[model samples]
Target: MNHLKFLLAIWKANLQSVMEYRVSFLTQVVGMMLNNFIYFAIWIVFFDRFKDVRGWGINDMYVTFGVLASAFGLVSLLFGNAFTLGDIINNGRLDYYLSLPRPVLLHAVSSRMISSGMGDFTYGFLSYAVSGPFTWDGLLRFVLAILLAAVVFAAFLILVNSLAFWMGIVSSFANLMLNAMITFGIYPITLFDNYAKLILFTVIPAALMGAVPAEYIRSASWQILAQLLLGAAILLGLAVTVFRSGLKRYESGSAIQVEV
Candidate 1:
Protein backbone atom coordinates (compact mmCIF):
# COMPACT_ATOMS: atom_id res chain seq x y z
CA MET A 1 0.00 0.00 0.00
CA ASN A 2 2.81 2.41 0.75
CA HIS A 3 4.47 1.57 -2.57
CA LEU A 4 1.18 2.13 -4.34
CA LYS A 5 0.87 5.55 -2.73
CA PHE A 6 4.41 6.39 -3.68
CA LEU A 7 3.72 5.45 -7.27
CA LEU A 8 0.62 7.60 -7.29
CA ALA A 9 2.58 10.52 -5.91
CA ILE A 10 5.20 10.14 -8.58
CA TRP A 11 2.54 10.02 -11.29
CA LYS A 12 0.83 13.06 -9.88
CA ALA A 13 4.09 14.97 -9.94
CA ASN A 14 4.73 13.98 -13.51
CA LEU A 15 1.23 14.98 -14.54
CA GLN A 16 1.54 18.32 -12.80
CA SER A 17 4.89 19.02 -14.42
CA VAL A 18 3.54 18.26 -17.86
CA MET A 19 0.44 20.32 -17.24
CA GLU A 20 2.59 23.33 -16.44
CA TYR A 21 3.37 23.58 -20.15
CA ARG A 22 -0.16 23.33 -21.48
CA VAL A 23 0.55 24.28 -25.06
CA SER A 24 3.42 21.85 -25.42
CA PHE A 25 1.32 19.17 -23.82
CA LEU A 26 -1.64 19.78 -26.10
CA THR A 27 0.58 19.94 -29.16
CA GLN A 28 2.21 16.63 -28.35
CA VAL A 29 -1.16 14.97 -27.76
CA VAL A 30 -2.67 16.32 -30.97
CA GLY A 31 0.47 15.56 -32.95
CA MET A 32 0.35 11.91 -31.95
CA MET A 33 -3.35 11.74 -32.80
CA LEU A 34 -2.64 13.09 -36.27
CA ASN A 35 0.24 10.67 -36.70
CA ASN A 36 -2.06 7.76 -35.85
CA PHE A 37 -4.73 9.18 -38.12
CA ILE A 38 -2.43 8.81 -41.10
CA TYR A 39 -2.21 5.07 -40.52
CA PHE A 40 -5.99 4.78 -40.22
CA ALA A 41 -6.37 6.69 -43.45
CA ILE A 42 -4.12 4.27 -45.27
CA TRP A 43 -6.18 1.36 -44.00
CA ILE A 44 -9.33 3.10 -45.12
CA VAL A 45 -7.91 3.48 -48.58
CA PHE A 46 -6.90 -0.16 -48.72
CA PHE A 47 -10.25 -1.45 -47.51
CA ASP A 48 -12.03 0.62 -50.15
CA ARG A 49 -10.45 -1.37 -52.93
CA PHE A 50 -9.99 -4.81 -51.40
CA LYS A 51 -12.97 -5.56 -49.19
CA ASP A 52 -11.21 -7.83 -46.73
CA VAL A 53 -7.82 -9.40 -46.49
CA ARG A 54 -8.07 -12.96 -45.17
CA GLY A 55 -11.37 -12.16 -43.44
CA TRP A 56 -9.96 -9.08 -41.74
CA GLY A 57 -12.22 -6.16 -42.51
CA ILE A 58 -12.41 -2.55 -41.39
CA ASN A 59 -13.96 -3.61 -38.10
CA ASP A 60 -11.09 -5.96 -37.34
CA MET A 61 -8.72 -3.18 -38.13
CA TYR A 62 -10.56 -0.96 -35.68
CA VAL A 63 -10.31 -3.53 -32.90
CA THR A 64 -6.66 -4.06 -33.68
CA PHE A 65 -5.90 -0.36 -33.59
CA GLY A 66 -8.01 0.10 -30.50
CA VAL A 67 -6.22 -2.60 -28.54
CA LEU A 68 -2.77 -1.61 -29.74
CA ALA A 69 -3.32 2.11 -29.20
CA SER A 70 -4.78 1.74 -25.73
CA ALA A 71 -2.13 -0.75 -24.67
CA PHE A 72 0.71 1.41 -26.00
CA GLY A 73 -0.83 4.53 -24.47
CA LEU A 74 -1.26 2.95 -21.05
CA VAL A 75 2.30 1.64 -21.04
CA SER A 76 3.70 5.00 -22.10
CA LEU A 77 1.58 7.00 -19.71
CA LEU A 78 2.46 4.81 -16.74
CA PHE A 79 5.86 3.41 -17.72
CA GLY A 80 7.32 5.80 -20.23
CA ASN A 81 10.78 5.23 -18.86
CA ALA A 82 10.61 1.65 -20.09
CA PHE A 83 10.79 3.00 -23.61
CA THR A 84 14.04 4.79 -22.75
CA LEU A 85 15.52 2.15 -20.48
CA GLY A 86 18.34 1.44 -22.89
CA ASP A 87 19.40 5.06 -22.93
CA ILE A 88 19.06 5.33 -19.17
CA ILE A 89 21.15 2.22 -18.59
CA ASN A 90 23.80 3.23 -21.07
CA ASN A 91 24.00 6.78 -19.72
CA GLY A 92 24.46 5.62 -16.11
CA ARG A 93 21.15 7.12 -14.96
CA LEU A 94 20.34 3.91 -13.07
CA ASP A 95 22.58 5.13 -10.23
CA TYR A 96 19.86 7.41 -8.91
CA TYR A 97 17.32 4.63 -9.06
CA LEU A 98 19.64 2.21 -7.31
CA SER A 99 20.14 4.66 -4.44
CA LEU A 100 16.38 4.97 -3.95
CA PRO A 101 14.73 2.66 -1.44
CA ARG A 102 12.23 1.01 -3.78
CA PRO A 103 11.99 -1.68 -6.39
CA VAL A 104 14.51 -0.37 -8.88
CA LEU A 105 12.76 -1.54 -12.03
CA LEU A 106 9.38 -0.28 -10.89
CA HIS A 107 10.77 3.06 -9.83
CA ALA A 108 12.70 3.48 -13.04
CA VAL A 109 9.77 2.59 -15.30
CA SER A 110 7.17 4.62 -13.42
CA SER A 111 9.22 7.78 -12.91
CA ARG A 112 8.16 9.39 -16.19
CA MET A 113 4.96 9.75 -18.21
CA ILE A 114 4.51 10.50 -21.88
CA SER A 115 2.22 13.43 -22.56
CA SER A 116 1.35 12.29 -26.06
CA GLY A 117 -0.10 9.05 -24.74
CA MET A 118 -3.33 10.92 -24.05
CA GLY A 119 -4.03 11.02 -27.75
CA ASP A 120 -3.50 7.31 -28.12
CA PHE A 121 -5.89 6.64 -25.29
CA THR A 122 -8.48 8.89 -26.89
CA TYR A 123 -8.02 7.30 -30.27
CA GLY A 124 -8.46 3.83 -28.80
CA PHE A 125 -11.77 4.62 -27.12
CA LEU A 126 -13.05 6.34 -30.23
CA SER A 127 -12.13 3.35 -32.35
CA TYR A 128 -13.83 0.94 -29.99
CA ALA A 129 -16.93 3.09 -29.79
CA VAL A 130 -17.27 2.99 -33.52
CA SER A 131 -16.35 -0.62 -34.15
CA GLY A 132 -17.49 -2.53 -31.08
CA PRO A 133 -20.93 -3.45 -29.91
CA PHE A 134 -22.43 -1.28 -27.21
CA THR A 135 -22.83 -3.87 -24.51
CA TRP A 136 -21.52 -4.59 -21.06
CA ASP A 137 -19.84 -7.79 -22.21
CA GLY A 138 -18.25 -6.02 -25.12
CA LEU A 139 -16.89 -3.27 -22.89
CA LEU A 140 -15.55 -5.81 -20.42
CA ARG A 141 -13.86 -7.74 -23.18
CA PHE A 142 -12.27 -4.61 -24.55
CA VAL A 143 -10.92 -3.71 -21.15
CA LEU A 144 -9.50 -7.19 -20.67
CA ALA A 145 -7.93 -7.13 -24.08
CA ILE A 146 -6.32 -3.77 -23.42
CA LEU A 147 -4.93 -4.98 -20.11
CA LEU A 148 -3.42 -8.07 -21.66
CA ALA A 149 -2.01 -6.10 -24.56
CA ALA A 150 -0.43 -3.55 -22.22
CA VAL A 151 1.29 -6.30 -20.29
CA VAL A 152 2.63 -7.82 -23.47
CA PHE A 153 3.88 -4.45 -24.72
CA ALA A 154 5.61 -3.57 -21.48
CA ALA A 155 7.17 -7.01 -21.22
CA PHE A 156 8.53 -6.71 -24.72
CA LEU A 157 10.06 -3.33 -23.95
CA ILE A 158 11.71 -4.59 -20.78
CA LEU A 159 12.96 -7.74 -22.46
CA VAL A 160 14.58 -5.77 -25.22
CA ASN A 161 15.95 -2.99 -23.03
CA SER A 162 17.58 -5.48 -20.65
CA LEU A 163 20.00 -6.19 -23.48
CA ALA A 164 21.69 -2.90 -22.58
CA PHE A 165 23.32 -4.60 -19.59
CA TRP A 166 25.11 -7.01 -21.85
CA MET A 167 25.52 -5.10 -25.11
CA GLY A 168 25.73 -1.54 -23.73
CA ILE A 169 24.30 1.40 -25.69
CA VAL A 170 21.59 -0.55 -27.47
CA SER A 171 19.15 2.33 -27.62
CA SER A 172 18.85 2.24 -31.40
CA PHE A 173 18.39 -1.51 -31.55
CA ALA A 174 15.83 -1.50 -28.76
CA ASN A 175 13.91 1.31 -30.39
CA LEU A 176 13.95 -0.55 -33.69
CA MET A 177 12.58 -3.66 -32.05
CA LEU A 178 9.82 -1.68 -30.38
CA ASN A 179 8.94 0.09 -33.63
CA ALA A 180 8.90 -3.16 -35.52
CA MET A 181 6.52 -4.70 -32.99
CA ILE A 182 4.16 -1.74 -33.27
CA THR A 183 4.32 -1.74 -37.05
CA PHE A 184 3.59 -5.44 -37.33
CA GLY A 185 0.97 -5.41 -34.62
CA ILE A 186 -1.39 -3.08 -36.44
CA TYR A 187 -1.91 -5.52 -39.28
CA PRO A 188 -3.75 -8.83 -39.53
CA ILE A 189 -1.74 -11.78 -38.33
CA THR A 190 -3.40 -13.92 -40.97
CA LEU A 191 -1.38 -12.03 -43.55
CA PHE A 192 1.71 -13.84 -42.33
CA ASP A 193 2.68 -17.42 -43.06
CA ASN A 194 3.44 -20.32 -40.73
CA TYR A 195 7.00 -19.45 -39.70
CA ALA A 196 6.25 -15.75 -39.52
CA LYS A 197 3.23 -16.45 -37.32
CA LEU A 198 5.39 -18.58 -35.04
CA ILE A 199 7.89 -15.80 -34.60
CA LEU A 200 5.16 -13.24 -34.10
CA PHE A 201 3.65 -15.21 -31.22
CA THR A 202 6.89 -16.30 -29.54
CA VAL A 203 9.87 -14.03 -30.17
CA ILE A 204 8.24 -10.65 -30.89
CA PRO A 205 4.71 -11.23 -29.59
CA ALA A 206 3.23 -8.95 -32.23
CA ALA A 207 0.22 -11.25 -32.17
CA LEU A 208 -0.53 -10.47 -28.57
CA MET A 209 -0.09 -6.75 -29.16
CA GLY A 210 -3.23 -6.65 -31.31
CA ALA A 211 -4.07 -9.72 -33.33
CA VAL A 212 -5.04 -12.15 -30.59
CA PRO A 213 -7.03 -9.61 -28.66
CA ALA A 214 -8.88 -8.46 -31.74
CA GLU A 215 -9.74 -12.02 -32.59
CA TYR A 216 -10.87 -12.80 -29.09
CA ILE A 217 -13.09 -9.74 -29.03
CA ARG A 218 -14.55 -10.48 -32.42
CA SER A 219 -15.26 -14.12 -31.65
CA ALA A 220 -15.47 -14.12 -27.87
CA SER A 221 -13.83 -17.49 -27.85
CA TRP A 222 -12.62 -18.93 -24.58
CA GLN A 223 -9.64 -20.53 -26.29
CA ILE A 224 -8.40 -17.26 -27.72
CA LEU A 225 -8.79 -15.53 -24.37
CA ALA A 226 -6.90 -18.32 -22.69
CA GLN A 227 -4.09 -18.01 -25.20
CA LEU A 228 -3.87 -14.26 -24.61
CA LEU A 229 -3.76 -14.69 -20.86
CA LEU A 230 -1.13 -17.40 -21.06
CA GLY A 231 0.98 -15.45 -23.51
CA ALA A 232 0.87 -12.34 -21.33
CA ALA A 233 1.91 -14.36 -18.29
CA ILE A 234 4.79 -16.04 -20.07
CA LEU A 235 6.10 -12.84 -21.58
CA LEU A 236 5.84 -10.95 -18.32
CA GLY A 237 7.68 -13.70 -16.46
CA LEU A 238 10.42 -13.77 -19.06
CA ALA A 239 10.82 -10.02 -18.98
CA VAL A 240 11.16 -9.87 -15.20
CA THR A 241 13.59 -12.78 -15.14
CA VAL A 242 15.71 -11.27 -17.89
CA PHE A 243 15.82 -7.87 -16.23
CA ARG A 244 16.74 -9.27 -12.81
CA SER A 245 19.41 -11.50 -14.31
CA GLY A 246 20.84 -8.58 -16.24
CA LEU A 247 20.91 -6.47 -13.09
CA LYS A 248 23.61 -8.78 -11.73
CA ARG A 249 25.82 -7.81 -14.63
CA TYR A 250 25.21 -4.07 -14.27
CA GLU A 251 28.32 -2.10 -13.33
CA SER A 252 27.64 1.30 -11.85
CA GLY A 253 29.43 4.05 -13.74
CA SER A 254 29.92 6.01 -10.51
CA ALA A 255 28.43 9.05 -12.20
CA ILE A 256 26.59 10.22 -9.12
CA GLN A 257 26.91 13.92 -8.39
CA VAL A 258 26.07 15.81 -5.23
CA GLU A 259 23.82 18.81 -5.66
CA VAL A 260 25.02 21.42 -3.26
Candidate 2:
Protein backbone atom coordinates (compact mmCIF):
# COMPACT_ATOMS: atom_id res chain seq x y z
CA MET A 1 0.00 0.00 0.00
CA ASN A 2 2.81 2.41 0.79
CA HIS A 3 4.60 1.64 -2.43
CA LEU A 4 1.39 2.06 -4.38
CA LYS A 5 0.80 5.47 -2.81
CA PHE A 6 4.33 6.54 -3.62
CA LEU A 7 3.95 5.44 -7.20
CA LEU A 8 0.68 7.31 -7.54
CA ALA A 9 2.25 10.46 -6.16
CA ILE A 10 5.13 10.19 -8.59
CA TRP A 11 2.75 9.64 -11.49
CA LYS A 12 0.71 12.64 -10.43
CA ALA A 13 3.81 14.77 -10.39
CA ASN A 14 4.78 13.51 -13.80
CA LEU A 15 1.35 14.39 -15.14
CA GLN A 16 1.63 17.88 -13.73
CA SER A 17 5.08 18.30 -15.24
CA VAL A 18 3.86 17.26 -18.66
CA MET A 19 0.88 19.57 -18.42
CA GLU A 20 3.20 22.49 -17.76
CA TYR A 21 4.30 22.18 -21.35
CA ARG A 22 0.88 21.63 -22.84
CA VAL A 23 1.82 22.36 -26.40
CA SER A 24 4.76 19.96 -26.42
CA PHE A 25 2.79 17.28 -24.68
CA LEU A 26 -0.15 17.55 -27.07
CA THR A 27 2.13 17.63 -30.09
CA GLN A 28 3.98 14.52 -28.95
CA VAL A 29 0.73 12.66 -28.37
CA VAL A 30 -0.67 13.62 -31.79
CA GLY A 31 2.58 12.88 -33.56
CA MET A 32 2.79 9.38 -32.10
CA MET A 33 -0.81 8.69 -33.03
CA LEU A 34 -0.21 9.74 -36.63
CA ASN A 35 2.96 7.69 -36.77
CA ASN A 36 1.14 4.56 -35.61
CA PHE A 37 -1.71 5.22 -38.03
CA ILE A 38 0.71 5.31 -40.94
CA TYR A 39 2.10 1.93 -39.95
CA PHE A 40 -1.40 0.49 -39.76
CA ALA A 41 -2.21 2.00 -43.14
CA ILE A 42 0.48 -0.04 -44.80
CA TRP A 43 -1.13 -3.21 -43.50
CA ILE A 44 -4.53 -2.05 -44.68
CA VAL A 45 -3.19 -1.70 -48.16
CA PHE A 46 -1.49 -5.07 -48.02
CA PHE A 47 -4.63 -6.81 -46.82
CA ASP A 48 -6.65 -5.20 -49.58
CA ARG A 49 -4.48 -6.95 -52.15
CA PHE A 50 -3.86 -10.18 -50.24
CA LYS A 51 -6.72 -11.22 -47.99
CA ASP A 52 -4.78 -13.04 -45.27
CA VAL A 53 -1.37 -14.34 -44.25
CA ARG A 54 -1.01 -17.86 -42.88
CA GLY A 55 -4.58 -17.87 -41.47
CA TRP A 56 -4.16 -14.46 -39.85
CA GLY A 57 -6.45 -11.66 -41.03
CA ILE A 58 -7.08 -7.95 -40.52
CA ASN A 59 -8.88 -8.59 -37.24
CA ASP A 60 -5.91 -10.51 -35.88
CA MET A 61 -3.72 -7.61 -36.91
CA TYR A 62 -6.00 -5.29 -34.99
CA VAL A 63 -5.54 -7.30 -31.79
CA THR A 64 -1.82 -7.55 -32.40
CA PHE A 65 -1.46 -3.79 -32.65
CA GLY A 66 -3.78 -3.30 -29.71
CA VAL A 67 -1.74 -5.53 -27.41
CA LEU A 68 1.64 -4.28 -28.57
CA ALA A 69 0.73 -0.60 -28.50
CA SER A 70 -1.00 -0.73 -25.14
CA ALA A 71 1.78 -2.77 -23.53
CA PHE A 72 4.49 -0.48 -24.85
CA GLY A 73 2.50 2.61 -24.02
CA LEU A 74 1.83 1.53 -20.45
CA VAL A 75 5.52 0.85 -19.85
CA SER A 76 6.54 4.13 -21.46
CA LEU A 77 4.02 6.12 -19.50
CA LEU A 78 4.47 4.50 -16.10
CA PHE A 79 8.08 3.32 -16.20
CA GLY A 80 9.67 5.43 -18.89
CA ASN A 81 13.06 5.52 -17.17
CA ALA A 82 13.46 1.82 -17.81
CA PHE A 83 13.80 2.65 -21.50
CA THR A 84 16.87 4.77 -20.67
CA LEU A 85 18.31 2.48 -18.00
CA GLY A 86 21.49 1.90 -19.99
CA ASP A 87 22.20 5.61 -20.30
CA ILE A 88 21.42 6.15 -16.63
CA ILE A 89 23.71 3.36 -15.53
CA ASN A 90 26.48 4.34 -17.91
CA ASN A 91 26.28 8.02 -16.97
CA GLY A 92 26.23 7.34 -13.22
CA ARG A 93 22.65 8.55 -12.74
CA LEU A 94 21.99 5.61 -10.44
CA ASP A 95 23.44 7.69 -7.63
CA TYR A 96 20.28 9.74 -7.52
CA TYR A 97 18.13 6.64 -7.13
CA LEU A 98 20.39 5.09 -4.54
CA SER A 99 19.93 8.13 -2.33
CA LEU A 100 16.19 7.57 -2.16
CA PRO A 101 14.45 5.42 0.45
CA ARG A 102 12.42 3.43 -2.04
CA PRO A 103 13.62 0.38 -3.96
CA VAL A 104 16.41 1.55 -6.23
CA LEU A 105 15.26 -0.36 -9.28
CA LEU A 106 11.67 0.79 -8.92
CA HIS A 107 12.67 4.36 -8.26
CA ALA A 108 15.03 4.44 -11.21
CA VAL A 109 12.58 2.87 -13.61
CA SER A 110 9.66 5.11 -12.63
CA SER A 111 11.54 8.41 -12.42
CA ARG A 112 10.44 9.67 -15.84
CA MET A 113 7.25 9.72 -17.85
CA ILE A 114 6.76 9.60 -21.63
CA SER A 115 4.01 11.97 -22.75
CA SER A 116 3.63 10.41 -26.21
CA GLY A 117 2.58 7.16 -24.64
CA MET A 118 -0.87 8.57 -23.99
CA GLY A 119 -1.53 8.55 -27.71
CA ASP A 120 -0.47 4.93 -28.06
CA PHE A 121 -2.67 3.88 -25.15
CA THR A 122 -5.66 5.70 -26.58
CA TYR A 123 -5.14 4.32 -30.07
CA GLY A 124 -4.70 0.77 -28.77
CA PHE A 125 -7.88 0.70 -26.66
CA LEU A 126 -9.86 2.33 -29.45
CA SER A 127 -8.62 -0.21 -31.97
CA TYR A 128 -9.47 -3.10 -29.69
CA ALA A 129 -12.89 -1.74 -28.78
CA VAL A 130 -13.77 -1.35 -32.44
CA SER A 131 -12.57 -4.71 -33.74
CA GLY A 132 -12.52 -6.96 -30.68
CA PRO A 133 -15.39 -9.02 -29.39
CA PHE A 134 -17.87 -6.93 -27.38
CA THR A 135 -18.53 -9.48 -24.62
CA TRP A 136 -17.45 -9.47 -20.98
CA ASP A 137 -15.14 -12.39 -21.63
CA GLY A 138 -13.48 -10.47 -24.42
CA LEU A 139 -12.96 -7.44 -22.22
CA LEU A 140 -11.44 -9.55 -19.45
CA ARG A 141 -9.16 -11.28 -21.90
CA PHE A 142 -8.08 -8.00 -23.42
CA VAL A 143 -7.23 -6.52 -20.04
CA LEU A 144 -5.31 -9.59 -18.95
CA ALA A 145 -3.46 -9.75 -22.23
CA ILE A 146 -2.45 -6.11 -22.06
CA LEU A 147 -1.23 -6.45 -18.46
CA LEU A 148 0.78 -9.60 -19.21
CA ALA A 149 2.24 -8.06 -22.31
CA ALA A 150 3.29 -4.95 -20.40
CA VAL A 151 5.05 -7.09 -17.79
CA VAL A 152 7.01 -8.91 -20.47
CA PHE A 153 7.97 -5.71 -22.23
CA ALA A 154 9.14 -4.03 -19.02
CA ALA A 155 11.12 -7.07 -17.93
CA PHE A 156 12.77 -7.37 -21.33
CA LEU A 157 13.84 -3.71 -21.31
CA ILE A 158 15.22 -3.99 -17.78
CA LEU A 159 17.11 -7.15 -18.68
CA VAL A 160 18.66 -5.58 -21.75
CA ASN A 161 19.53 -2.29 -20.05
CA SER A 162 21.04 -3.99 -16.99
CA LEU A 163 23.82 -5.13 -19.29
CA ALA A 164 25.25 -1.63 -18.99
CA PHE A 165 26.41 -2.42 -15.46
CA TRP A 166 28.82 -5.09 -16.79
CA MET A 167 29.45 -3.61 -20.23
CA GLY A 168 29.66 0.17 -19.93
CA ILE A 169 27.94 2.41 -22.50
CA VAL A 170 25.51 -0.20 -23.80
CA SER A 171 22.68 2.22 -24.54
CA SER A 172 22.91 1.53 -28.25
CA PHE A 173 22.55 -2.20 -27.81
CA ALA A 174 19.64 -1.78 -25.44
CA ASN A 175 17.88 0.56 -27.85
CA LEU A 176 18.42 -1.83 -30.73
CA MET A 177 16.96 -4.76 -28.80
CA LEU A 178 13.99 -2.70 -27.62
CA ASN A 179 13.28 -1.43 -31.14
CA ALA A 180 13.55 -4.91 -32.57
CA MET A 181 11.06 -6.23 -30.01
CA ILE A 182 8.59 -3.45 -30.81
CA THR A 183 8.99 -3.84 -34.59
CA PHE A 184 8.56 -7.58 -34.57
CA GLY A 185 5.79 -7.61 -31.96
CA ILE A 186 3.45 -5.49 -34.05
CA TYR A 187 3.50 -8.04 -36.86
CA PRO A 188 1.87 -11.47 -37.02
CA ILE A 189 3.88 -14.16 -35.30
CA THR A 190 2.91 -16.84 -37.79
CA LEU A 191 5.29 -15.33 -40.31
CA PHE A 192 8.27 -16.75 -38.42
CA ASP A 193 9.65 -20.26 -38.96
CA ASN A 194 10.13 -22.88 -36.24
CA TYR A 195 13.63 -21.81 -35.25
CA ALA A 196 12.69 -18.15 -35.24
CA LYS A 197 9.61 -18.97 -33.19
CA LEU A 198 11.77 -20.77 -30.66
CA ILE A 199 14.05 -17.77 -30.39
CA LEU A 200 11.13 -15.41 -29.94
CA PHE A 201 9.77 -17.56 -27.14
CA THR A 202 13.17 -17.87 -25.43
CA VAL A 203 15.95 -15.34 -25.93
CA ILE A 204 14.07 -12.33 -27.28
CA PRO A 205 10.61 -13.36 -25.99
CA ALA A 206 8.92 -10.99 -28.41
CA ALA A 207 6.03 -13.41 -28.76
CA LEU A 208 5.26 -13.17 -25.06
CA MET A 209 5.12 -9.40 -25.24
CA GLY A 210 2.22 -9.40 -27.71
CA ALA A 211 1.76 -12.43 -29.93
CA VAL A 212 0.91 -14.97 -27.25
CA PRO A 213 -1.60 -12.76 -25.52
CA ALA A 214 -3.17 -11.84 -28.84
CA GLU A 215 -3.51 -15.52 -29.60
CA TYR A 216 -5.18 -16.14 -26.26
CA ILE A 217 -7.68 -13.39 -26.97
CA ARG A 218 -8.39 -14.74 -30.43
CA SER A 219 -8.99 -18.22 -29.06
CA ALA A 220 -9.10 -18.40 -25.31
CA SER A 221 -7.13 -21.41 -24.16
CA TRP A 222 -5.80 -22.27 -20.73
CA GLN A 223 -2.51 -23.43 -22.16
CA ILE A 224 -1.68 -20.13 -23.85
CA LEU A 225 -2.68 -18.16 -20.77
CA ALA A 226 -0.48 -20.32 -18.58
CA GLN A 227 2.41 -19.88 -20.94
CA LEU A 228 2.00 -16.10 -20.98
CA LEU A 229 1.74 -15.85 -17.19
CA LEU A 230 4.64 -18.22 -16.54
CA GLY A 231 6.83 -16.50 -19.08
CA ALA A 232 6.10 -13.09 -17.55
CA ALA A 233 6.91 -14.35 -14.05
CA ILE A 234 10.17 -15.95 -15.15
CA LEU A 235 11.30 -12.93 -17.12
CA LEU A 236 10.38 -10.53 -14.35
CA GLY A 237 12.28 -12.63 -11.81
CA LEU A 238 15.29 -12.76 -14.09
CA ALA A 239 15.22 -9.01 -14.66
CA VAL A 240 15.03 -8.28 -10.95
CA THR A 241 17.88 -10.70 -10.27
CA VAL A 242 20.04 -9.17 -12.98
CA PHE A 243 19.39 -5.61 -11.85
CA ARG A 244 20.19 -6.44 -8.23
CA SER A 245 23.32 -8.34 -9.18
CA GLY A 246 24.50 -5.45 -11.33
CA LEU A 247 23.84 -2.94 -8.57
CA LYS A 248 26.76 -4.42 -6.65
CA ARG A 249 29.03 -3.22 -9.45
CA TYR A 250 27.51 0.25 -9.68
CA GLU A 251 30.02 3.08 -9.27
CA SER A 252 28.63 6.51 -8.63
CA GLY A 253 30.07 9.48 -10.53
CA SER A 254 28.82 12.03 -7.95
CA ALA A 255 28.69 14.65 -10.69
CA ILE A 256 25.57 16.41 -9.44
CA GLN A 257 24.26 17.04 -5.95
CA VAL A 258 20.88 15.41 -6.48
CA GLU A 259 18.52 15.00 -3.51
CA VAL A 260 16.34 12.32 -5.09
Q: Which runs in model 2 stand beyond 4 Å of their true positions?
A: 257-260
Worst 10 residues of 2 by lDDT: 251-260
TM-score of each: 0.95, 0.96
Displacement of the residue 48 alpha carbon in candidate 2, Å: 1.0
Model 1 residue 158 distance off true place after TM-score fit, in angstroms: 0.5
Off by over 4 Å in 1: 257-260
Q: Kindly list the per-residue Cα lDDT of model 2 for residues 57-81, writing each as its tens digit.
A: 8888888898888888899999999
Residue pairs with clashing backbones, model 2: none
